[model samples]
Target chain A: MSRPSTRPGLPRRGVLRLAAAAVALPAAAVLAGCVPADHAVTDPGPGPGGAAEGVEGRVTDARGRPVAGAFVEARGTGPRPNPVPEIAVFTDGDGRYRWFLPAGSYAITVTAEALGRRTLAVTVPHGRAVRLDFVLG
Target chain B: MKPFHAIAMASVLALWAAGAAASDRAVEAGVRGPVPGPSAGEAATAAGMPYAGSDAVSETELAASGVTLGTAPVGPLPAEMGGSEVILNWDSRMVLKTTLYPNRAVGLITRNGAHHCTGWLISRNTVATAGHCVHSGRGGTWYDRRTMRFYPGRDGASSPYGSCGVSRMHSVTGWTVNGNRDYDYGAMRLDCLVGNTVGWFGMYSHTAPLNEPAIITGYPGDKPQTQWISSDKVRQALTRQVRYRMDTVGGNSGSPVWSDRGEALATSGAWGYAIHTYGNAGAQYNGGTRIVSAVLNNYINWINRP
Candidate 1:
């Protein structure tokens, strides 16, 4: 992302001159685009919460065994004005939670109040089903 | 006078003239507020926003005072995920790292100017960032010099067009005054319209599952003037909270904990929650500060209201 500039007194001409100067310095562009974008998992099918579109996952302990009654959540992110909704649910006796979510980018967090908490941030594309598993200590 | 001295004098005069003209334009544009840049002492006033004693003012009074104390805004996702999902999409060999911080990093600048950090603009003028970035001293008072204005997409001292002031500031009731890590989020009311800039990110109302993939973004001091993004492997999930590993350092404290679509899920807080390490080695860990419906509603009401 580009940081905004706050220099007080540059006219249009001055701005052009600065732009020219900046171009002369190749490192400026490199520095300008320094931060890398996030690479997250994208949803390939219907998002959770949609009819026949949801996330199914199991919460387990470090031993790779199922842990019952884990809390599961589905979240999504988007531009301003409108954004995806965040949803939450609890696991069944089989330690599974099926969350229905709108199609978009989401960050998921799961917690077993009695046991512990864990989080996963991902994107749920449209018409796709994503599965996540949590292992607590 | 020597020739070099004469040249230097001319240059200084030209620079002064340019600065004066710019100041005049800013005033005409209504960007200039009554108070000049806030001093360090003034930034400390935010610490005062949250009262410590029982005799302190009520939330109503604080709201009247223009101090917005509540959660961030949450909204629905876009119909289409069309924008660039990745920052550096061309690079395929790069691998994102996950880290955590024991102490949250907050960006502080003078009141008038913008403070640069990876923060989320939850409202038109309200922003959510780490409390440590805004406060200092034993009581964690807001620091003025460091409390510069905020420019979401800032490039060093330049803020192009986007600029906002700290009209009001709010944080979790207890964390505001006591420096509690569990609730390390802080919100600021802006003087300008954030919508004109990079725009604000929406909050999530529903809960998310643990052990899912996540991406983190922020501007690191080591690489100032630029933003960094990283993806972490989902480790586990506990009750009410989730833990994950990401590569983060000091200056990234105020960075937004965002979902894949750039929506902010939580503000980076202390090292960790419960037994997990908030900061292990050099990585930072974050717990989900659920943006449920009620919390999101409160945040929206606060920012949307006059």
Candidate 2:
């Protein structure tokens, strides 16, 4: 494989140029082992204003079973005073809960009246479906 | 204008230095000695399946490539750039600049000539980037992968080590089903043990103040190149969106927004300016979904569980 280069301090544009060259130049010329998988493809999604949707998934226990009636809450990172609102839901029979929100930072909390609580933090981008599964003790 | 001029000059200098130092520290830290790698949950291992989609990759792939995810320790940036800016205000724990990764590594999967997105390791097998990088919403569908690979230590288009396939993936319900930007975060369970060469980052259990200086870092495109902005100031919004004065570009999506202390508070995604559509613009505005303590706690519990 081609050895990773560690030359720092290259200008931002310079780095970009180098990257372009790296991509265009023959992989065989630089390094032998490191090869770009022919499987790799690039599909830049639609530009801004595409208003991507959010993600949704279910939370379950250790036995591959859903945690019924568990309380599910959602929180996010933003500025203060107007920080992303924390939304909550209860798991249905299938241990599933869903919420629609804007694209941003987020954390999910699962709590049961008897089982305490657990939280998982994640980042959701525009037009994506992020799946977070919680396994309660 | 004397006092105003002095303040403006100070701010400008600070910003410049912060930007420079942020990148410097990230590169420096990446080269440092061994850091902790991601651990597998006993329950996950025993069950032979990860909670989310950690099973996307196999052990053979991870071993062949030596790919791992997580954070490295980054030193402080120059004093200017407001490295001490506070972004989240919780209880006693003040999330400072010393704790977060200003830059992040994102890996895009090319299968059947389509590129799906995922993030790189900062501290543990824990990788933080954009939620959209992995899953998507088109035709009322979610991009669920049965198999994929990750290149954590990729510097440019080359993987210094080998590449590993994903074992599992995780995201919040609101983010997946509701398109809620507020709760846009995800985690993955790797199939193999990421050695010390790759590490994970720390999280702020509490909160900090608003309008604190913060740094944002990430790989804009599939290339392993990264960028940093130090002197940027962010105003915490009541809506959980921390608005900041920083110039970001495309391919920067899924980057991490970190406190001066190196604690990741958010990840980059959507941009506020119209130039975002063209993928070329300077002095443009980009936003990241923040990592609140409540959500982080959930992730911790899931990852650490036996």
The estimated TM-scores of all candidates read 0.39, 0.42
Model 2: per-residue lDDT, tens digit, B1-306? 554344445555544533332221111121212222235543322111111112234456555544542233322322122234333222111112212222223233322222233354433344444444444422223334334455543334444334555555555444544444554555554444442233334443224436655455433322223222323555543343454544433334454454433321232211111001111111233355554444444444445533
- The deviation in Å at residue B143 for candidate 2 is 2.1
**Which one wins on lDDT?**
2
A100: Cα error in model 2, Å: 14
Residue B195, model 2: lDDT of 23
Against the true structure, what is model 1's DockQ? 0.01
Q: Write the per-residue lDDT of candidate 2 for residues A1-137, one digit (tens) a residue.
A: 97549655566767776665455343323332322111111122223333344546787777778877675555554442112222224566788765444466766677766667899876676656577778887
lDDT string for model 1 (A24-53, tens) is 344433432331111001112222222233
lDDT of 1 at A83: 22
Residue runs of model 2 more than 4 Å from their true location after superposition: A1-137, B1-123, B137-140, B222-231, B260-284
